[model samples]
Target: MNRTMVTAVNTLGQLHKQVDLIGHNLANAETAGYKSREASFADLMAQQINNYSSAGSEVGRQSPLGIRQSPGARISQTAMLSKQGSLKTTGRPLDIAFTKENQYLKVRVQEDGTSQIRFTRNGELDIVNAGDQWVLATKDGHLVLDENDQVITFSGKVEEVKMIQPGTLEATMDNGQNIAFRLGVIALNKPQYLEQMGNTLLGLPDGADNNINQIYSDLNGARRQEISLQQGVLEASNVDIGKEMTDLMASQRSIQFQSRSITLADQMMGLVNGIR
Candidate 1:
């Protein structure tokens, strides 16, 4: 009976985490460029006990001559879904949306007093003043980088900026000087290796410096693959609230069922103790 209770308790714990993950998805349903995560469950180890030594005596047995006691179930792994979201036209020139789901924009970030490179799916752009010059950046204020790994900077009031090609920007400066910049974008063949840095920022793993080139490919200039991009547009969050709600209800039911099993185990224990 105690073992039964333990198994139910373990399953309940895993169910709780699954519920929390569902809640997170629902909360981010309106967040721009947010991706949903999914969890998979697996059964724990089981102990098999043989009940009969002579199989010839139980020739008509309908089931196996053994009892299997399983520890419980657990969340095996969680995977991020990288499907492209719906495109929303914002009518703002800086707003950009990547039709390719695997593409990410390169941004310069300051973390722990150290400058580092990060990647993001968020396309909301802003121009911020950095001392003597103004640089293009994300809405979060992370400086956007060009193909040369440098921040896109300009002086004086920005006259106009347009997307001449996929991931390429053309800006007309105040002095009527037209300059073209190819935005730095990387195609992550396997985004599962990326380390989440919060606020939609992702980075390479702790020691993946050597394998970055092998796993990710730069999409710029001649190496640039055909991409569908649109300026003055944004990508909405890919989360589906209806599916998330259904998953939430299912997880809640699992929790309730596990609790009932624990209750039944306790009642069984009481009945056995009362045997005279």
Candidate 2:
């Protein structure tokens, strides 16, 4: 195939990937605690041409300009934006929002008969009875954890629950007992390393050496207290609808231009073949 066609094909492929990413951001615009991702493009390796004249070579010296032919462009990385989203108040005691960045709540999930810890920014929680124990859990039934990495559970029925402070919860049990527990607000050292597990939950990537216990320990040892929680509110998605729409239009135009370039290259090849 011609070099123009090859470059156009590669460019089109990258554009397609970018468009897909933009679409994904738009689709999750209203999702709670959803972080938007931006696709980064980089030029491919370029063919370098040496300039003998510029190098002061004695033989066959020509123009001093150095020429380079870039192969095309590609999506190099998809970085998640860490910008904080606006908080919406729901007036529900179980709903919570982080006032600081890079903080998340820890939850325990059971998958395939094994329980694993995951993190999330979505704090819309509910109370459920699990084997005669009342536990604070997410809507999907994952048990929320406390500061000690243990599931937040009550022995008896929870009559009333209130947020005494940002991270402290006071619960009144049916058996005339009141208990106070600190909510687990973990500050991630590197939030970008978290992989999206569906429903706004994030988990460590497969084969990652870091676990929930290790991360919690690190946060405690480092004395990192940059994060604070807000009760009765939830964080909205960071996606900007207008920006995503503009990017979609730009990517569509680029794709169309590359498609035209490929068609023109094919037509030029046909003309060359017809020449006597």
Candidate 3:
């Protein structure tokens, strides 16, 4: 294959990948708490061409062989967007939104009712009948617990789960009830580095100190703040549809341009081959 042609083909492949990513972002634009990813492009190695050494003897001699450039740019990484999405309101008591400084709720999720705890910020709360009482749950249908508690799945509908401020609850009910939830205090020194476990929960990542005091600093005070849990209001998704549409158009155009370039290169190659 000709060097330039090979490079163009590689670039075309990268563009296709980028288009796919853009399509995905647009598709999930309305999904609750969905984050958009951006594709990153990187140039392939550049070939050093036309080395001109201007010493007295070598001034006039121009090199005929040009250094070969590798195939075009490639899609490198899809960086995750950490930007805060705009919060929309739906008036429902279970629908709680986080206004706190980088705090999320912890809930239990599973294929069955027996799944482990995961973290999420989709803080729409609900109630489930955990055998005896009702308990709180996060949106996306996870049962919220006070501690690492098991969920009591019910065959019927649940009613009356309360949303206390975060850090108020010491333990949670198995059926999404907040019986133990009360005004309380947790003394954590380094709360900022909490690892995100999907579904409104945070935990100590492995090889890190679970002991809150090991990371405690007098300057780094972990003061308690109350999270307002609005009853009957849910937080809507943060995806910006306008931004996603713009990105989709840009990716589509780039793909089309690359496809055209490849087609033109192929036509030129065919002409050369036809020459007798």
Candidate 4:
């Protein structure tokens, strides 16, 4: 295949991948606590020619110059945008929204008989009966964990649940005992390192520190005062429909132009071969 055609093909493939990412962002525009990803492209290194000496001076001879050929563009990386989304009031007691950035609620999930800790921005939760105890759970039934990294359970029937302050919850039981538990709200050191675990949940990569110590430090400092949690509210996805539509159009146009370039390259090759 011709070099121009090869380059065009590679670029077209990258544009297609970008189109897929845009489609994904559009699909999750309404998903709560969803973060959008932006795709970046990078060009390959240019070809270089070794040192050409001008000692063999031929009159009116031009010096040999290195050829800068672009192999093609490639999807360098897809980075998650950390912009905060708008909050929607749901008026539900279990719904919560974080006013601070890079914060997430911690939850525990049972997979293959083993429990794994996961982090999520979605605060829609409910109460579930796990055997003999009633524990706070996400909508998907994953147990919501407390600061101790243990499942938060009510000692008796929960009569009322209220947020006394950010990262703190107070509940009144039917037996007249009021229990207060600190909500496991944590700030990630590097949220970009978080891996999406489906259902708007993110999991810490293996070997990556949970950053629990950082959370503790923040709680002890004045940063804790900046963290605010709003009950009865949920965060909407941070996707802008207008921007996504513009990106989709641009990608489509680029794909068309690349296809035309490949076709022209093929035709030029045919003409070269036909020369007698």
Candidate 5:
């Protein structure tokens, strides 16, 4: 295949990936705490046309240039947007809104009937049935843990969970952030390292060695305060619908234009072949 065709193919692939990301963002526009991701690309290396200057004895070399085709472009990265999502009020005590500065909540979830912990910024929590017991779960339905390091499962309609005050929640900076309540708090060495387990909850990645006991810490050294939870509110996705729509249009047009260029190139080559 021609070098131009190769470049065109890669460009089209990039466009397709970009469109998919935009569609995903739009689909989750109403999702609580959904963070949109953007695709990034880099230019492929092309052959140097001439050696006008050189450090050695190759100054002003006039030899025929050799073709050095690029390996082709690809989606280099998919960076997650860390911008604060909008806050919405739900008037339900279990609903929580994470502030911009110190966003993220820690929770444990069941993996193959076993439990693991992870952190997320989304604060949507609810109750669900598990093994004949109603358990307090994250909005996505992961079990919530109590002071005893046991999954806090409730049965049937139970009283609302005790609302902890902002003042009561404490933060200790370390390998993982340590969050404290009067009764108990879990210490996370690297909250960001926790893997996403869907439904606004996260779990430890495989091969991780996270212990429940590490979450508690009595040594109150240089630590900041933890984010306090409000009873009746949930955080909405931070995605700007208008901006996303605009980006989507731009990506669509780019793909169309690039595709047309490829078609034109093919037609030009076909015409040349017929002339001989």
Candidate 6:
């Protein structure tokens, strides 16, 4: 009805979105290698109108001499926090964790009968028997990509595996042969462009590589970036429970305040209509 009510209603919708985001982060608090998301708000377009034509009485006033009408605020960005989480020792040979911030392991996810490359920090790895060979994969069955961005497949039986060095996995085959697979990792050059797919995977928007810097490695070393990973350990989720709760409470308060404003505006309109 009025600008006050309209603005309040609009802002309330955005605040609810922030609350939903906070809840999502809290729900994933125990998910390994999960990163927290932070939402930011930006004010909508505002109209500045001169309420008074006379500046005679407002000569010494320091504030602006106009009424600003805004349609409230909206969630501008929900940036992913890439801070490193605490390392947890799982004692499992396949459980791995990245030791550096902004570093993510590469995996191939199948969608719509095609394989797409995605990045993730979750390191719960497993070896599965493919049709003809054994392949390294995530717990969700996404194929693990090696230094060449190719599927890490072994021709023989992998009896055991361990991390002998950073980003390198040493696998002992059943025939007493030791094969080393260097995992592929990418440093997030522009994580803001990443979209969150399901199964703890983060993917590029529309499969664009312009947001990433190529840094695959060979047996010798990486071309531009180096990665560090340790076996038998997993990275805890970076979500801070206490902070999320606090944010949720604050958002609820704001919603309540905005709702009250809308109610007051409605009452004022009713009173004006009923003027005697």
Q: Give the winner by lDDT.
A: 6
Supply candidate 3's per-residue lDDT for 200: 32
lDDT of 3 at 94: 54
Candidate order (TM-score): 6, 1, 4, 2, 5, 3
lDDT of 3: 0.56
Candidate 4 CA-lDDT value: 0.82
Given candidate 4, what's the lDDT at residue 14? 97
| C-alpha root-mean-square deviation, each candidate | 2.5, 3.7, 7.0, 3.8, 7.8, 2.6
Over 4 Å off, model 3: 45-70, 100-102, 111-117, 129-135, 145-159, 167-178, 182-232
At residue 108, candidate 6 shows an lDDT of: 98
* 4 or 5, greater by TM-score: 4
Pick out the ten consecutive residues of candidate 5 with the lowest summed lDDT: 215-224
**Global lDDT scores for all candidate models:** 0.86, 0.82, 0.56, 0.82, 0.62, 0.87
Which model, 1 or 2, shows the larger lDDT? 1
lDDT digits (tens) for residues 7-118 of candidate 2? 9999999999999889889888988888899999999998878654444544564644667888799998888787899999999888888877778888899978999888
Error of 4 at 39 (Å): 0.9
Model 3: per-residue Cα lDDT over 1-276, one tens digit each: 766567777887887887777777777666555556778899898777765545775656575444556568987766555455566666655555554333345556673555654445565555655675545555566676543344533344444444454544323334565444532122324554455443234455555655645643211123444343344444444556787678778877876777777788889899999999
Instruction: Give the TM-scores of the predictions, in the order they appear.
Output: 0.90, 0.85, 0.64, 0.85, 0.71, 0.90
Evaluation by lDDT, superior candidate among 1 and 6: 6
Name every residue pair that clashes in candidate 4. none
Query: Which regions of candidate 5 deviate over 4 angstroms?
Result: 45-72, 110-116, 146-150, 154-157, 167-224
| TM-score of model 1 (CA atoms) | 0.90
